[model samples]
Target chain A: MWKWLHPYADPERAYQLAGKLLPWFSILALGLILTGTIWGLMFAPTDYQQGDSYRIIFIHVPAASMSMAAYMGMAISAFIGLVWQIKAADWAAASIAPIGAVITFIALFTGATWGKPMWGTWWVWDARLTSELVLLFLYLGVISLYASFEDKVLAARAAGILAIVGVINIPIIKYSVEWWSSLHQPSTIKITEESAMPTEMLIPLLINIFGFGMMIGALTLVRFRAEVLARNGMRPWVRKLAQEQGAA
Target chain B: MQFESISDFFNMGGYAFYVWLAYGVTFSSLAVLVFQSVKQKNKVLKQIAQKLAREERLKQNRSNNESKT
Candidate 1:
């Protein structure tokens, strides 16, 4: 299994791969986000109860969903690095932390903005809100842990352990609304049941979700490539690449 | 289309402050993140290039001294 995965474990190869994919991710993310924001903000019918206040969903839902998804991505990368001692995996985990934290912050900020009008308060100690706050702290913890070490490889290992331990919060965040009495409403989109939102509203929400996903991918790739170069700066191939870049 | 006029759209049916604030914060934050990441990548590449160039200059000087000797 390790043999099959050997090629991608090379930082140079991973850097090349990320470079090739970055343009596509950036373009698609821009296009989808533009389309979704226009449609959701302008064309989607006002909610019967919330009116245009609900328009914020275009940003809030996508940001909220991506916050959790980014954590999962980081955790998975951390797990791989820990188990296989793969340098690329560690780089990926490190690159993902700040992006995840940014998204989480956006979620919390937007959640508060949305809550003010809907719940008549900016925040509550609701299960969903509290758990999401914890998720943000966990992201910060991973980042600080990684930076604490003089040796990056050692830092990555320590951060990887913390990220893995923090996996317990992911499920708690996802299920908090269902398990506890909370001011935060249940998810508008569901995996099994037909969505309560009508098609017009649902479509743009889905578009924004995909758009945000692509944006995250593009950002992560850029950061990951930088990490790869920085970590491998002393390697012959990286030096050669840098010389080529200088010439160009 | 949902609103009656430009003003109505901007007003966002009396929820303009909250709605715009949410979108404003989210998009601005995302833009900053993307901008910072791109800038960081370029900075790292430039630093690496400078290091390689310095190494090349040192190697050339060493070879020149060796030949002269």
Candidate 2:
């Protein structure tokens, strides 16, 4: 099962692969984010009830969803590292921590700003809001835990355990609105049912979601490449690559 | 164009603060993350290069002394 992934387990090979993919991810992410943001902010019609304030959904929803997605990505990498003892998986998990934390922070900050107009307050202790805050803490925990270790491998293993443990919160954050009464609106987009939003608004929202995902992917790849280089700095290939880069 | 004019667009139908703040914070945070990651990568690469160069110099010195002996 893991045979096909054997080549990428090598930090050098993964670094090269990340390098090759970075340009495409970066270009597409920038293009999509710019197009989606402008279209959503200027082109999409205002909400009948919430007026222009609903426009905040363009950024808030994507950041909120991507925050969860980023956590899942980290957890999956952590699981792989713990089970397979793959250093690249651990590095990938480590690479995602700060990015996930920042996105989560954006989600919270934007959500609060959006709430001010809609909820009549900047924040509420609702289930969704509280759980989302927990998710941010989880990301921070993984980052600090990883940083506290002298040995990279040991740190990865320890942080991987925390990430795996934190997986329980993802579902809670997703389903919080359903399980409890909350000031937060329920999901407008659902996989099992048709979307509540009209075509004009839904289109931009979907575009933003894709754009945010790509942005996260591009950033994670960049960080992962850096992690690989740092971890393998003593390797002959990395030294040679550094020499070539220096010469260039 | 959802708004009648540039000012109206910026005003966002009296919800300008909330809408702009949300987008502003989201984009700025993402921008910071990207900038910091790129800066960190450059810093790591420079450190690695410096370490490699120092090791190369030390190796050269050791070999030169061996030749002299």
Candidate 3:
């Protein structure tokens, strides 16, 4: 079963695979995000209460959710690296750290901007908000830990441990609003039950969500390819790639 | 569709500042991320290429010196 994946565990094969998939993800991200945001901002029905201020939801919700998703992906990569000792997995985790951090920042920033109008304040120390902030810090911590060590192996180990440990925060962030009374509203999009939003508004929002996921995937692949090159600089394939790149 | 005119659309029913600000910053950040990722890959490739070229030159010079000796 897992034998098929063994080939991609090689750095060169993984790099080529990422390269092949990058364009599709990028194209889908571009198309979906454009359609979603345009429909959302211009065509979606205004909220009965929040009015057009809710237009920010087109982006805010996508960024907010994808941030957590990116973290989960990072943690999984870290877990794989720790257990299987796969260098590519460690590279993938490292590649995801900065991207996840940026998405988390976007989520927090957009949430704050949205909060200013809806909640009459830029920020509050609410459970949901605070936990998300800690998520950002966890991303930063993993990044710094990865950068701190002289030995690459040790750096990966440290960062992987931190990423794995940070998994505990994901559930906390997810359930914070429910577990504690907070200014933040509960999730608008629900998996099991009917969403709070009507279909007109929810369609574009869902499209944007998938768009953000593809964007994150494309971005991660780009960074992961770079990591592969940097890590395998001395390898024959990497050197050949460098030569080809120079010639091109 | 939601607005009466282009200006009204731009206004975003009095929520333009918040809406546009969030969109502007978010999109710009995404653009920067794309730029940085491509730049990083190019930079790594350039460094590796340069290192290889330098090594090749060193090897040639060593061979030349040995032949002269």
Candidate 4:
């Protein structure tokens, strides 16, 4: 089943593949996010309660959801690196950490901006909010662990373990609102049941969600290419690439 | 359009500050990430070039010394 994925385990192939996908992801992300933002800001009907302030939800929800999704991608990469001993997977995990951290920060900041008017406060120590904050810290921890050692194999091992252990937080972040009487509202979009949001409002929000996912994918590929180059600096192909880059 | 005028849209129905602030911060941060990633790739490539150049010079020196001996 996974035989097709074997070719990408090689750094050269992985780097080239990421390069091929980057443009598509970048173009799609740009189109979808622009369309979604315009439709959301101008066309979505005002919330009966929050009014225009609810527009922040377009960015906040996407960033919040995609932040978790990026973490899942990172953890899966880390697991693959540890289990299959694939160096490309470790490079991918490293590539994903900073992007995940940035998206998580966007989520928290946008949530705070949204919270001020609706909740009458910029922040609260509610379970949902706290867990999301922990998620940011977890991403930072993985990044710092990977950077702390002189020996990269040891660093990757340590970071991989941390990332694997941090898998417990994703479910906690997802269910925190339901598990506790929290200030953060339960999810408006549901997969198994009808969403509370209307079609006009929900459509742009969903588009932005997917747009954010593509943005993460594009950014991850950019960083993954860099990681591959940095890791394989001694390889003949990398030297040839360096010479070509120098000439260009 | 939800608003009748450009000013009204800019005002964001009286949420101009918060709404624009959130969008501004989010987009700017993403822009910064893009800049940093491209810069990192360039930096790595430059380092590799420098290392290769240094190795080439060392090889030249070694050959020169061998010819002298």
| Local distance difference test scores for all models | 0.92, 0.91, 0.94, 0.94
Ranked candidates, highest DockQ first: 4, 3, 2, 1
Indicate the fraction of true inter-chain contacts that candidate 4 also forms. 0.77
lDDT tens string, model 2, A1-248?
A: 57898999988889999999999999989988898999999999989999999988888899899999999999999999999899999999999999999989988998998899888999999999999999999999999999999899999999999999999999999999999999999999988989999999999899999999999999999999889988988898878777777433
Q: What's the ranking of the predictions by TM-score, best on top?
A: 4, 3, 2, 1
Q: Which of the CAPRI classes, incorrect, acceptable, medium or high, describes model 4? A: medium
What digit string (tens of lDDT, one per residue) describes model 4 on residues B1-69?
778899989998899999999999999999999999988887898899999999999999999999999
lDDT (10s digit) by residue, model 1, range B10-69: 999999999999889888998899889988866777899988778889999999999999
TM-score of chain A of each: 0.96, 0.97, 0.98, 0.98
Ranking of models by lDDT: 4, 3, 1, 2
lDDT of 3 by residue, A66-118 (tens): 99999999999999999999899999999999999998999999998999999
lDDT tens readout by residue for model 1, A12-68: 889999999999999999999999999999999999999999998888899889989
Q: Which stretches of candidate 4 lie over 4 Å from their true place?
A: none
> What is the Cα-based TM-score of model 3?
0.97
Better of 1 and 3 by lDDT: 3
Q: Which 10 successive residues of model 4 chain A have the least lDDT summed?
A: A239-248
